[model samples]
Target: MSHIVSIQTEIRDPVAIRSACDRLRLPEPVFGEVKLFSSSATGWAVQLPEWRYPVVCVVNAAKLAFDNFGGRWGDPKQLDRFQQIYAVQKATMEARKRGHSVIEQPLEDGSIKLTVNVGGAA
Candidate 1:
């Protein structure tokens, strides 16, 4: 049996966030108050590539605050990629935790295909 899952990503797990950052080769997230433009936010600060300010993720509230300056400060694609990879890493981790086996394939369209076998050997 198989299933298709659509995830609306809300970054709340610090471990998963770290895993995603590692997978993307980005800098580790720092937990503290960060300055974003003229404002400030407190959370785990993830520095996206070429971004002027780091994205602050309030894990407890499942919220993210950032100042992109309408793509001038950073490319939205980087954030999108981060979200996608984060979702994949989170799902894969949960599946494996339940003794499921997972296989990942990177599609040509830049999307990933994760095949999970439930109750299967790792």
Candidate 2:
């Protein structure tokens, strides 16, 4: 009924993972090399729990894949939330890497806009 979707994220640093968790405020511990969940995954996985089929993370691939047990790849709402937080973290990391300062501003419509400033003349 469910499906597996591999989400290739820009998430490289474990610290970014911690920040994402903190930003979303997950209820339980979703850490370590790998983990599994029954509800909507806040962390990441790519396995369907079953009696007829068994799946597991057997390789060390640096990625964040979440299992969709809701008969879909994932819940749109939850995935959006994850994307929002992940966007900020990823943008910030890239901005800093390019020698720019990243600033996040919350808009009236409840959307965050990232502004990067490369100081030099302006």
Which candidate wins on TM-score? 1
Which pairs clash (backbone N, Cα, C closer than 3 Å) in model 1? none
Per-model CA lDDT versus the true structure: 0.93, 0.50
Residues 1-122, candidate 1, lDDT per residue (tens digit)? Answer: 55788778999999999999999999999999999899999999999999999999899999999999999999999999988999999989999999888999999999999888889664
lDDT of 2: 0.50
Best by lDDT: 1
When summed lDDT is taken over every stretch of 10 residues in candidate 1, the lowest stretch is 1-10
Cα lDDT tens digits, model 2, 17-41, are: 4565567664322343453455222
Clashing pairs in 2: 45-65
Off by over 4 Å in 2: 1-9, 27-63, 71-74, 97-99, 107-111, 120-122
User: TM-scores, in order shown?
Assistant: 0.95, 0.51
Q: Model 1's lDDT to the true fold?
A: 0.93
RMSD of each: 1.1, 10.3
